[model samples]
Structure formats: structure tokens, C-alpha cells
Target: MAPKRRRTVDNESKEAVQNRSSMVTRSRSAKYVKISDNNNSPVVVFAHGAGAPSSSEWMIRWKNLLADSLNAVEVVTFDYPYISQRKPPPKAEKLIEFHSDIVKMTAAKYPHHPLILAGKSMGSRVSCMVAAENGIRASAVVCLGYPLKGSKGAIRDEPLLQLTVPTMFVQGTKDGLCSLESLEVVMKKMKAVSKLHVVENGDHSMKIAKKNLELAGISQEEAEQSAVQAIAMFVSQTIGAM
Candidate 1:
């Protein structure tokens, strides 16, 4: 009887341990994403581009820049499930639902504060889609390198047309996927207030050419810093007007 009781106790203890481990794994995967250490209002929920994860250099840099620059804006970053699972990049259309869910969750978590949906490249497109389709009210949307047209000249202007909220696009002048001309044409049809801040001679990643940097009398780091500063300004002004 004593041996049987000991066996039961051990089993219970092992079960408890397993339960704890499972919880930890779930928590880790849950993306407990809060922007900045302090509680700041008007959180900017940023989504990473198709090519990179939320922890990539570009995402981290922008996250820190927005957090520090805005002072009041907490910049939250998140990863898509496919990226989390280390799977190949899925179609952008397939990703809109997932990204919208995160945005909705973030909005629900902080009900009082306003939200600014911002994303990089493909992520930016996703943000626009969510803002247009889902009824989640974002104060504004910022697209850091909007892919207006695919490399094969396939245009994706529907999302831009559907948005009724104020939007700001920070586009690189030299980006192949989104030529300045193509984006301008699409912007004309958008009813919402929109602004385009051009990054002179920058690529899709907003990396300025070395020659262009020399022309601006700034280093590569300075060029990126300048772009971030511009983004910070746009966020501040947009949020302030609202």
C-alpha cells in the first residue's frame, strides 16, 4: 500500500512539472509584446517586412527610434506565425488576417490609448489592408517602403484606395518595387489625407547610396537616423493633430 501511494505521488508531481513546462512554452510563444519599458499612450504597433523577423536590425532600430523619438508613443513589434515557425514566407494576402488579429489584440489590450499602425515594406501593405478591411480604428497608418508594384509590374493599389484614415508613406526614391511615379498615381485616388516623405536615393530598405550620403554630407548611419527622425516627426504631428 505504501509503494502504491508513493507511485501515485510521483506521478502527480511529474504531471505538475509537465504542466508548468507547457505553460512556459505557451507564454514564450504568445508574443507578450509591449513597447518600451514605460507605459506610453498611442502605441505604434509595427509589423516586420516579409524578408525579416521582428528582431531584425531594421525592426529593432525603428522600434527604438520611434520609442525614444516620440517619447509618448510605445512602439510594439510582432512576428507573423510563419516567421515564428521558420517557414517560408507566405502570400501577403494570406498574412493580412494574421496581422489584423495582432493589431486587434493590441488595440484591445490598451483600449483608451489610440493606435498607429505602421509596417515595413510588405508589412506596410498588410497594415493598410488591416486598416481598410478590419474595422479597427487606427489614428494613422505609416508605410515605411510601400511596395506599390511588384518587380514584374503588378500593381497593388487597392489597399491604398480603400483607406479612409489619414496615412503617411515614407518611400525610398530609388525603390524598384515602388517607383515614386507609380505611388504618386495611386495616392491621387486616395480620399484620406496622405503625405509622402521621400528618402533621397534610398533603396527599398531605406539604405541610401554611399554616393548619395556623400552628397548629403552625412554617413550611412546618419542617413538612416535622418529617415527615423522624419518618421518620428510624422508620427508626432499626426498624433498631435488628432
Candidate 2:
């Protein structure tokens, strides 16, 4: 009888250990998200472009820049599951639910702070899709190089047209994916109040040529800094007017 009782106790203890380990694994995975330590409002959830991970140099650089430029309480960024899982990138529409979940989590975490959804290229397009969803209610959206056209030059303006929140676009003058003229036409049809910051001589990633930078008499960092400053101003004015 004693041996049977000991065996039962051992089984229970093993089950308990397994349960604890499972919980710890889940908690650790949740805690692994990328978030800044600053505890302040205007929490910005930035997303990465299709070609890079959240830890890529461009994403990391802009994440810090956004934090400083917006004086945000914190900036949250995450890689899309496809990138992490090494799967092919899906259409922007397919990513709405996943991206919205991240925004929902971040919004819940900082319930009292102003929420801003910003992203790079394809991420920016998805950000617009997520922002246009019914309950997300972001205070504003800042699109960094929004991909407004397909590779074949089909216009993708439906998401932009649906936004109810104030929006700001940081577009490069030379971005082929979103020609300023086409963007202007779409902007005319948009219901949301919108603003644009044009980066002179910049391409899709807002990368200005060295010669152009020299001609403009500003370093690459300086050009980006100017864009960041424009973002800061737009965020400030938009939020203040709200």
C-alpha cells in the first residue's frame, strides 16, 4: 500500500512540474517581445518592412529615432510571424489580424497613453489596414515609405481611404512604389486628415544618394534627422489638436 501511494505522489509531482514548465515557457515567450524601457504616453508600435526582421539595422535605428523624436513612453516593435517562421510574405490583407493583435496587446499594456501605429513599407501598408479596423482606435498613424502601388503599378489605396484617425506620411521623392502624384490623387479621396513629409532625392527606404546629400549639404544621418523632426512635429500637432 505504501509503494502504491508513493507512486501516485510521484505522478502528481511530475504533472505539477510539467505544468509549471509549460507556463514558464509561455511567459518567457511573451516576455521576449521587443519594447523600450521608457515608461512615459504616446506609446508607438512600429512594424518592420517585408525584407527585414525587427532586429535589422534599419528597423533598430528608426525604432530609437521614433522613441527620441516622439518622446514616447515606449516603442514596441515585432517581426511578422512569416519572417520569424521563414515563410513567404503574404498579402497585406492576410496580416491584418496578426498585426492587430500586436496593436491590441500594446494598447492594453499602455491603456492610458496615446497610441500611434507606424511602419516601414509593407509594414506601413499593414499598419494602415490594422489602424482602419473598428476597435483599434489609434490616435494617429505615421507611415514611413508606404507602398501605395504594387510591383506592377496597381494602386493599393483602399486601406488609406478607410482611415478615421489623423495620418502622416513620410514619403521619399524618388520612391517608385508610391509616386507622389499618385499618392496625391489617393489623398484627395481619403476621409482622414492627412499630412506628408517629402524626403528630397530619397528612394523607397528613404535612402538619399551621397551626391544628392552633398548637394543638399546634409549628411545621410542629417537628412533622416530632418525627417524624424518632421514626424515629431506632426505627432505633436496632431495629438495636441485631438
Candidate 3:
């Protein structure tokens, strides 16, 4: 007799089976805030950076800003277990599995909606890893304050290199973690279509100097708003292409 194939459901996607019953309940300290102007809009799930909880001022500001700025898209933000537990974050590789679980839960819950994974700094790297490993294609990815290198100046381009989906990277001009010159080199080597937006004089957190903002004839708010808008525009174009 011929060997028989194992049963497969939902078009035989392992991602479907692996996460089918693995829906993650939002932790006690976690929240699922959604912003949607249109029901048909793509779902944008944002993971918090390594150092900050989802409720941190930076995350809160961007959560509200991206939701408001992205307008039509639905944006959801959540905290990592370490952040919720008040402990030091695990190494980057260790967080990918957990991050993937959260993302898979979100995607499964919103099965029909186009999904977009986004993150800040270390979170961005995790997003890319999940997309690459899970076999689930995201419409696009938006990397806010991507940490291209560690504090020790070691390049972290492997995750960026493995991404198969379009990725837009919003980096601060002065961010030591992501040296523009080095990032450009990695981008050139990437097979994925990559776009970069430089936040003039901004740092790791994308904070601009009041002096520089004054010289540029734009308010700090305007500089910040531009960063959000750039990501919004990237989503718009990417969604349009899809």
C-alpha cells in the first residue's frame, strides 16, 4: 500500500495548525487597543520595544499617533511577558518565539484582514524573524527605530536580511544603534524592497532636539508627526500595491 499523507486543514498550512488553539490571553498588565477608521483596513499589530512596556509614554504616544495617523488601518499594541513581569528582557533571539505567538494570535483572530507587523528597535527585529519563520506572509512591515547594531557596535543584519516582505525602516539620524551608513549597506544587500526615513537629528527614541527643530522651522511635534506619517504613507503604498 502507498504511504498516506497526514491530514492537513486550512489549506495545509502548518502555521494554522501550530497556532490554532494557542490564542494568547492579554496579560493582566497588557491591553488590546484597536484603532480603525475603516472596517476593511489592514490590521497593524505593533510589538513594544525591548526596554519599554506597552504603557510607557513613548509607546502610548506612538500608539495614539499611529492609530490616528494611519487613520483607516487598525493598530494594536501589546507588551512582552518580560515587560509585563517587570524583569530584564531576554536576548533578541529568545523573544522571537514569544513575539511570534502574539502575532499569530492576532492574525488568527483577524483571519480575513490583511496583517502588518510593526515594532520599535528590538521589537522590529523580532517582527522580521516571525515573518521569516512562520511561513505566514505579512502585507508589509514597518520598523520604527530599528536597532541595526548592538551597543558593542556588532551589526545585527541577519534578521533584516532574511525578511521576504517589504519593510520600511524609520530611523533617527543620530541613533547610535542604527548608523545610517551601515544600515544603507545592509539595505543594499537585502533582497526585500526596503525603504528608509531619517528623522533629522533624532535619537534612538526618535526624539528631536528643540534647537534643531527650530532651525528646521518645524516644531518637535511636526518632526514626530512626520515620522508617523512616513510609516502611514508606506502602509498606504504597500497596501495599494497588494
Candidate 4:
């Protein structure tokens, strides 16, 4: 018997299909692979922040940048089931289960490609938990704006410390969601290979002040370019070593 051939989607057709498919709504469905070029590149799964959808402006921007700059990598973003609700959000356990299921399904779909897990804020925490609990081996994990504590100042410390994969934490110096001091402490305790990059004057969303941008004559686009460059470099180095 002969082996079955896989169907490959072209860049143009994939874009058209994605645009048309974006209209179909599911009550608790998570969005997947936004702004893809259909290049069938290595997959990078992205998780959105708490209270935000996968199509939020920031996520969309990042996805597009990755598609344009790293055309060989497909960026997939998914919303937590709680964020898709019409009413109150679901409990933490339910949210974790949803994230875990999405990761598993994605990994199965792209079984041969290198899988990278990337997340923002609460989403990053969930990604770390999924990686740890399932014993799943990702090429690398990238965390943007990781939250280290609750709004009321209570500390949460399991995600970073228990990670087994090569992880990179990209944080803003002025981010209010997570304290650099606390994150540093956690990083010091971690057993896995970890690295942190602090964007000077960047806020929780990696937005910088106009004054600073003007002083350096660096536009917001440039800042985003810098971030993408850093992430791409890290991904390349880590994947190469592996």
C-alpha cells in the first residue's frame, strides 16, 4: 500500500480561506492562526491575555509582524473559553483545561514541525502550566508580559520555576502587572535554562512613551521591529542548539 499524501495550502488561497472562515462564530471557540501567509512554516502557538480575545489589537499586530518578518513561521493564537463567554468568565481550572486541550490538538495537527508556545500575561502562565503538566516538549517557550502576582500584591510563583523547556521572558520595565524584582527572584530559583529581556520604558503592552520615542527618533513600529528581532534571534539560537 502507498502512503497518503498531505494537502498543502498556498499563500493566497490560505489567506482567502482564513478571511472567509473568520466570520463563522462559535460560542466557546478559540481563534487559530491569524494573519498567516500559508507558507506552512514552523508553528508558534500564541495564547491571549486574560479578558482579551485572540483577535485583540496587540495579538493581531504581533501575529502580522511574525507573518511578515518570519514568513517561515506560522503564528497561531487562541482565546481561552472564558473569554469567549457572553456572561461571567469560567473558573481557573476550566480555563486551564481549555488551554491544555488547544495545545494538544495543535501539536497533533502539526506533528512534524517544531512547536513553540508563546503567550502574553495570564495566557503565558497557562502555557507554562500546560507544558509542565503534560510533559510536552516545545522547541522553546516565549512569555511576553508574564504576570507574577495578583492585583492585590499576592505572589504566584509556580510557572517560571518549574519549566523544563528553554524559556524567554520579555518584559517591560514599567509594566505594572509584574514586578521586575519578583520576577528576578523567581528566575534565580528556576532550574531550567531561562533568559529575560527588559524593554526600557515599555509598559505592560510594550508601549513606550512618546517623549522617549521622540528623543530616540524611534517610532512604535521600530520598537515592534526590535521585539520581533529579539524573539526571532532567540528562537533561532534555541532551536539550533536543540
Alpha carbon lDDT of each predicted model? 0.70, 0.77, 0.72, 0.67
Number of the top lDDT candidate: 2
Model 1 steric clash pairs: none
TM-scores of the models, in the given order?
0.78, 0.83, 0.81, 0.78
TM-score of 1: 0.78
lDDT of 1 by residue, 1-242 (tens): 01000000011133433343331111101111222334435677899998899999889988876666555445788889998688988878899888888888888888877788889999999898898875789988989899888757899998888998778787777798898667766766687667666666779988877766665555656555555555555565666676
* Candidate with the larger lDDT of 2 and 3: 2
- Please give the range of 10 consecutive residues that has the lowest summed lDDT in model 1: 1-10
For model 2, the superposed segments whose C-alpha errors exceed 4 Å read 1-40
Candidate 3 weakest ten by summed lDDT: 2-11
Candidate 2 colliding pairs: 40-73
| Residue-wise C-alpha lDDT for candidate 4, range 1-242, written one tens digit per residue | 22111111112233423443342221111113222344334577888887678888989988786655545456788777556565555534456777777777777888876678888888788778777866476877888888887767877777767887877777777899887667766766776667665565778877889886666455667666666655666666666676
Stretches of candidate 4 off by over 4 Å are 1-41, 88-93
lDDT of 2 by residue, 18-93 (tens): 3433311111011111233344248999999998989999999999988877878889999899997899899888
Where does candidate 3 stray beyond 4 Å? 1-40
TM-score of 2: 0.83
Report the error of model 3 at residue 40, Å. Answer: 4.6
Residue 119 shift from truth in candidate 1, angstroms:
0.5
**Residue 100 in model 2: lDDT:** 97
lDDT (Cα) of model 4: 0.67
